[model samples]
Target: MTMLNQMKKSLGLLLLCTVLESHADVLIDVTATMVDPACNIRSENSSSPLAIDFNIINSSELNKSAVVKDFSLYISDCNFSKSLAMVLNPKGGSTLSYNGKNILATSIDGLGIDFTEVTGGTIRALEMNKKQRIYPERVNATLYRMDLQAQLVSAVPIKQLELGEFTSTVTLSVTYN
Candidate 1:
């Protein structure tokens, strides 16, 4: 009986060794992107939820010329970066794309708003997620003032303009390199 038990133990050990030997080696590829930390974003007035009031827009005036309002964003405490961009995403997924332009749709029907980024005398219309260059060149400054403008645009014919109190909300996000 002792001899038989010893044989069974030896056989079990051999099977365990064979099972261990059957294991295969695995190679894994690891990757990661090193992103610069985000900077502090604030309204030009150093307040939350930057707002621009297009006070008392005359519906009839939209046909004469687009109503324009200027606003600013104050950026500070930013990590050293070579460049940065501001991405505009209007809330509620409201937007109007007309004639090769993207406009932010407002609460009022037939009315929309267009945005332009002003950088050092150069003004360019901002496209959705186009990553428009907020920094013309590499910058290391800790404080920055980003100037912008909002222009009232009509999605429908001027005759179809809606009259009432209106509101619009857009979330501004920053990406840095």
Candidate 2:
């Protein structure tokens, strides 16, 4: 309507934008309660260990195929009032060396664990860097299952084969919408 009014509105808009921008994405230190989960994962391991062992894989085996183990993250007794999502911590709980593809770093060089979500999609390093494997589902009246697969892989060209143990534990957390 008026030049002065228009200038004032623009200034207000600029101030609003600056304020919003400054307030964006503050630091977050996440802590999991574990005391109450919308649902509980059921597995045979009573000690709360989700692990797989590739017993003494040869160079050829590592080169040819990836050793894989199947595990399911079953959610029982879901009490989510709204939709929920399950995210696997990008670091997988423990920080171990990683191959180029973000697979678990092995004790010996040129070895890694090719992690994937058989039921969902390919596994990446994390949500921010790569696509984090997340399973989102509507609040259901029954149990929900997320099946995952991991493989022991070797680089195409074998440099040196060292005998050692490779292990990893991934931490998982939940968020609601």
Candidate 3:
């Protein structure tokens, strides 16, 4: 081959090699999104069961026992005035007594479950256990821990507010490892 042609080919090959070498270090951008379930409350005035639905996404990885510590329920009404009274029954073969006198808290604010009256609806560390006791012979039952049914008693009758809506706001928080 001619000297000039050979020189030209060499320069082109060297340029190609330089381009390939420069492209070796790649810059990539990555991102992801995490979604969690929405939790809320439900209730009724008459002597009926209060059904609560917990929206749990990626529940497979959840340790039910560990997560229960962070679980809580705050039943309150409008005007932010009154909270439905509740009682705590420890695990033992106890008698079934629904005396109006066995009320835990007067207003939702009086209930020391959470910190504050409005926002203090949290179930504290001490309140949590490996399992919850709902009734007699039903020890270690799952009824009280995750899903619970409580009878509501108001100190004064639940008078109808002009708002015309009987509502209970429940908030659930979950902390996992």
Clashing pairs in 1: none
C-alpha RMSD of each candidate structure in angstroms: 5.1, 15.1, 18.0
lDDT by residue (tens digit), candidate 2, 1-177:
599999999999999999888855779899865644555665535347665666776667766666678776666665555555555544533323445444454555666566566555545333212335345333356766666676766653565656666555555554453
- 1-177: candidate 1 lDDT, tens digit per residue: 999999999999999999988968899999999866777777757777667888987788888987998877777766545577778888887888855877788898868889988756689888654565685322345677777888888878877876889998888887773
Decreasing TM-score order of the candidates: 1, 2, 3
Off by over 4 Å in 3: 1-5, 12-24, 29-165, 171-177
Best by lDDT: 1
Give Cα-based local distance difference scores for all models. Answer: 0.78, 0.57, 0.29
Give me the displacement of residue 42 in model 1, in angstroms: 1.0
Stretches of candidate 1 exceeding 4 Å from the true structure:
1-33, 136-140
Best model per TM-score? 1
lDDT of 3 at 115: 17
Query: Which regions of candidate 2 fall more than 4 Å away from where they truly are?
Result: 1-38, 44-47, 77-86, 90-101, 120-133, 136-140
- Return model 3's CA RMSD, one decimal: 18.0
lDDT of 3: 0.29
